[model samples]
Target: MKNIRNFCIIAHIDHGKSTLADRLLDYTGSVTDREKQDQLLDSMDLERERGITIKSHAIQMDFEYKGEKFILNLIDTPGHVDFSYEVSRSIAACEGALLIVDAAQSIQAQTISNLYLALENDLEIIPVLNKVDLPSANPEEVTDDIVELLGCAPEDVIHASGKTGFGVDNILAAVIERIPAPVGNVDEPLQALVFDSVYNPFRGVETYFRVINGEIKKGQKIKFVATDKSYFADEVGTLKLNQVIKQSVKAGDVGYLITGIKDAREVKVGDTITDSANPTINPIDGFEDVKPMVFAGIYPVDTDEFEELRSSMEKLQLNDASLVFAPESSAALGFGFRCGFLGMLHMEIIQERLEREFNMTVITTVPNVSYYAFTRKDPDTPVIVNNPTDLPDPSSIDRVEEPYIKATIITKSDFVGNVMSLCIEKRGQITNQTYLTPERVELSFDMPLAEIVFDFYDRLKTVSKGYASFDYTPIGMRTSKLVRVDILLNAQPVDALSALIHADNAVHIGKKMCEKLKELIPRQQFDIPIQAAIGAKIISRETTKALRKDVTAKCYGGDISRKRKLLEKQKKGKKRMRQVGNVEVPQEAFMAVLKLND
Candidate 1:
């Protein structure tokens, strides 16, 4: 255990965290000949599809230096700000971090943010300059920048091209030399911190943790500090912490536990796993109360597929304990769940997975920030609402508070004005600004979490010509004029199509919703009026033309069989839709309204 070095790779988005992780695995011979992928740490299909590290993945390796065996446990963390909390928790489990910086791109806002977090945790920092093989590589300049930024000696910098495998051996050596060995007493009772977890259909919940004290083994009875429940550990799984050998993981080690606990609700990520005999005096921190800022209702396209949707979400939650859900029933839309997530990115990931992994189509309402409001008469009491239909009487509302975030944008100086103007238009208040480099500036602002969530990231890149990088952290709540925008089909309200928006932007928001409805919802069997209304006044309206008749007028005896089959298919298709009076609306009608731009 003294030879083990546990570290995590931190960097901004596209700074090559996953690529560097792959290079480390390749250099240490951890990746087998048959299993070499470009970015191996991004194991999820969605991660690969999105080209982002949405989740933290860990792998172990063995490297030999000066005739001594060194074990390296590396965790790959998400670069996006939406998952910053996950990144923080990942850093909590590591003793060191490989701060990967693009030689050409220099340091980004997230680089500084994550670096500060790593420093706060007192983790040893090994600065690595990646992408040195690129044409714009400036190793010397970036090295100097890092030295000044991190206050580390220039000689300590590790220059490496993870893409070309250049200088990878030196990076590995630096890990062994610079990262301190795990320090703890093995004689103490077993205690481990559950930093991350994944759901395996075969093994149920596979929890990854760092053994903080004592020893853990297969068949040992363990107790969770959060749940106060005792369970027998079925087995302890070993990662490739050097060579492939089965051994009981003890204190100062990193590994996984596979208990036959199918219910993910029982085991949370940040829970303490300890020996039932003598729980450690300082138990691991219980799961942090991660509040889901974005609230959306998810429903299947076909009502019959509701069961499948629930099953998929349950399975997904087994791996992601951060997601929150509650069964919600709508008079017009049947049964669905009001799902809450950390932010928009989290919601998108879950939506994409359900469509791709479970082979089910789903409709999602527009993402909304939960609000707390009180009516004039009920000033002392507050109401929390996600759906507009649940909004308390406007007359009763005394004040409303919305969640806001402190956002930091790092971009080339050329985009500073554009970003400032864009943020100002979105109700953002400039807080602070700093020059990261002669050509780059870091701008901080207090913006509503809802403002920057949906397309702000892509818009930032577009306006800045892909030179802008950003990160954000929550900064509590603030007073705002938030209201519910109701969507009407024909003359009745469609609960699923309702959205919460700032009152000032309701008219513009309604127009956008109408446009998105045209793109998201298919034509109905009858002309459906998609109208956004405030109170009884309609702000925006568009009609979707009725779908053409599927059954032909003439049917021969032989063709009658085919016509019957066609009729049966049409009937089954109609079964997937809900009829509200004369209009035949698909589940997507509600979902399309959520994505106004799409």
Candidate 2:
């Protein structure tokens, strides 16, 4: 146990975390010459293409220092704020973290947030400055920033270039010297923390865990404490370039377990795995359930495939434990599942994964935040309204409360005014402001969660010219004057296109929704009236003109009265068609509501 070092890498997005990880693996001789590649720990194709780490990857490395062999378990984590939950889980399973900061960009919002997370867990922090090879890199300035942020000595900061593998040996030495090893009793009952899991079509679910006490052996009966389900361990192994099968994995080791449990729901991440016969007294602590910030509906393109979509979601949930969902039905979109996501990026990644991995094409409705609605009769009991259609009648409602978030933004001083105006336009109130440096500023704001759900992040990037980094944490709900805006096609309300908005911007948003839908919805044989309404009052309207067929073309050179009669007949036919014909709301129209500001 003294020679074992378990740690993870945490950083802001595009801060050279993965690149530094690759150099570490190469120096430790964990991979062969053929296996060498950039971003080696990022195994998913989507991750490589987007240059982001969507999942946390764990791998074992072996090294020898001064005639003594050492075992290193490195877990690479995502840098995006949406996957902070993943970082938390990874931190729980490790004793230390490598806090990587980009020398050129200095410290950003996500860096500060992730650093706080590590500090809360009491993990040993080793500050490393990466990307020193770039011409724009400012190692001296960033080193000073790290010293101020971490309160460490000047020489304590390590200068490294992931591209050139500089200072890789020093990082390894620091891990062995600074980070503590796992401390547990091998004689104690089995107590393992399951940090992650994945599904396999051929075998079953594979769970990756860290053994805190006792040991797990192949063919032994193991049980998940959360689910209280037991199964025989078909295989036990350590995570590497390829899974290394082992007869047994003892305490203070990181490994994988296959129980042949075909059902994905059986294995829960953050659950305790124990020996069925001699179980541990209690489960691990500090693993809190994920709080979803955005709610949206996901439905199959074909209604009959609802069951298939359900199964796909179950398998996906096994891989991504942060995703929460329940069955729901919509009048216009039929049966679907209301999914809770961390944020818009998290929601978009899940949708993309559903299409790429499962071969399931789906339609996602307008994303919204969960709201609390109270009625006059039941003023004390608040109804959770995740969808706009779930809101109670306007007459019976007492008041509605919406979730708020404490947003932290770090940007250059030049864009401070632009960023502040953008936040104020989103109904945000400035809470605090501080200068991290003469040219860099950190701004804090209290904003409604619903306000930033659509385009706030994108606009922030735009206004800051990609120099700003943003992070947010949910605050308690506050009462707000909100109203539900319903989109109607030919005077019939479409539940799928409806959204709850603040009363002040209801008319403006309603007008935008109407005009956007007019351009998206195709022209039919009869005119389709697109209306945005708040209850009986229509706030805005747009008309998609009908496709006309010239019935008078066949009667060319005929009497003017004859042409007029033919035109009147066509108008009457259009009116009759408008009454009986149903408007087919294209999929694009449902998504168009999100791009109202465009």
Candidate 3:
């Protein structure tokens, strides 16, 4: 245990965390020069393409320095704010963290958020300044920022360039000298925390765990403390580049345990694994279920493919326990599932993966955040609603509460005015603002999470010219005068097109939605009226004129009376068609109004 070092990397996105990991892997010979690619720990194709770590991955490295052998357990965590829960679990699993900050871009939004998390976890933090080789790098300024933020001496900060090999070896030496080794009671009954897991078709579920007490071996009967499900361990081993089977995984070690249980549902993150016969007296703390914050509906483009979509979702969920979904049907869209995700990015990644990996075509509705609705009769028992359709009638509701977030945005001084205006437009209240440096400023706001969950992030990136970074934490709930708006096609309500919006902008949004639907929906034989309404009152309307048959064509060169008679007959026919004809709305027509203000 004295030779074992457990530490993970935390950084802002695009801050060279993955690059540093790769450099360390190559330096230790854990990954051969020929075997490594950029962002080696980020194995998913989406992750590689986006250049971000979406999932947390762990590996064991054997390093020799000064004639001493050290086992370094490196856990690479996601840098995006949306995956903070995942980051928290990774931090909890380790005894120390390698906090990497880009020298050119010192202490962005996620940098502060993750630093606080590492401090809260009581992990020894090794501050490293990356990207020192860049022409714009300011190592000294960033070192000062770290010293001020972490209260560590300027000399204690390690400087390294991820792209180049400079200071790479020195950082490893620092980890050995600074980070503490894992300490646990080996004689205590087995108590391991399941931090992560992946599903295998042949082996059932492959679980990654950190042993806190005792040891686990092949053939031992194990039980998950949360589910109380027991399975005999078929194999237990450490991850060396890949799965390397071993007879036993001792306490203070990070390893994988294969139970030969084909069902992935039995194994979950935050669950405790203990010996069945000699169970531990208490389960380790800090295990939290990943509750999804964003909700969206996913339906098959072809109704016949509903079953196929279900199978794809089930298979996908086996690997991603954070994803939540249940069967739901829509009048406009057939049978489908309403899915919950950690955030909008997570929702998009899951949908993309389902299409790319499973070869499934799905139609995803606009994402929404959960809201609380209180009925006048049951004001104390506020109802939780994930969809606008589930909300109670406006008359029966006493008050509606929406989720709020405390957001921290780091941007250049030039764009502070623009960022402030954007936040105000999203109904944000400025709580505080601080100048991090002469050129960079951190703007803080208390805003509705519903507002930020939509196009706020994209708009921030656009208005700031990609120089801004953002991180937010939920700040409970606040009352809001929000109402649900419904879109109607020829007086027939389209339930799938309903959206919840603030009462102040309902008229403006209704007008734009009605007009946009006019452009998207094809004209029918009979005139169709596109309308937006709050309850029974129409707020906005647009007309799609019916096609004219040119009934007077046959009357050419004939008398004027003949032309008049033909026109009158055509008018009567059109009137009769309008009385009975139904609008045939295509799929794109429904998706056209997804983002009204985009």
Most accurate candidate by lDDT = 2
lDDT of each residue in 169-251, candidate 2, tens digit only: 99999999999989998899999999999998988899999999999999999989999988998999999989999999989
Clashing pairs in 1: 366-594, 374-398, 375-396, 375-397, 376-396
Q: Rank the candidates by lDDT, best first.
A: 2, 3, 1
Position 188, candidate 3: lDDT? 90
Error of 3 at 8 (Å): 0.9
**lDDT for predicted candidate 2 compared with the true structure:** 0.94
Q: Which tens-of-lDDT digit does each residue in 1-598 have in candidate 1?
A: 7898899999988899998888888888887878888778777888888799988887888788899987788899988766777787888899999999999999888898999989988999999999999998888888988999989999898888878888888888888888998887789888899988777778787778899888888888899888888888787866763223344787778888877888767777788898898888788765456778788888776788887788788877766667789989886667889998877788888888778777878777767777778778868776877677788877677888888999888888888999999899789999999886788788999999888756777778888999988887889878898777887876778777777788899999998887777666667665667888887888999887767685745655675678888888776665455353455466565555544554
Count of backbone clashes, every candidate in sequence: 5, 0, 1
Which residue pairs collide in model 2, if any? none
**What lDDT does the true structure give each of the candidates?**
0.81, 0.94, 0.87
**Could you tell me the TM-score of candidate 3?**
0.94
> What's the CA error at residue 579 for candidate 1, in Å?
11
Error of 3 at 6 (Å): 1.3
TM-score of each: 0.89, 0.99, 0.94
Among all candidates shown, the one with the greatest TM-score = 2
- Whichever of 2 and 3 has more lDDT, that candidate is 2
* Candidate 3 structure quality by residue, lDDT tens digits, 342-412: 88788888989999988988888767889999999999888998888999989999999999989999999
Better of 1 and 3 by TM-score: 3
Instruction: Please give the distance, in angstroms, between residue 596's alpha carbon in candidate 2 and its true position after superposition.
Output: 1.9
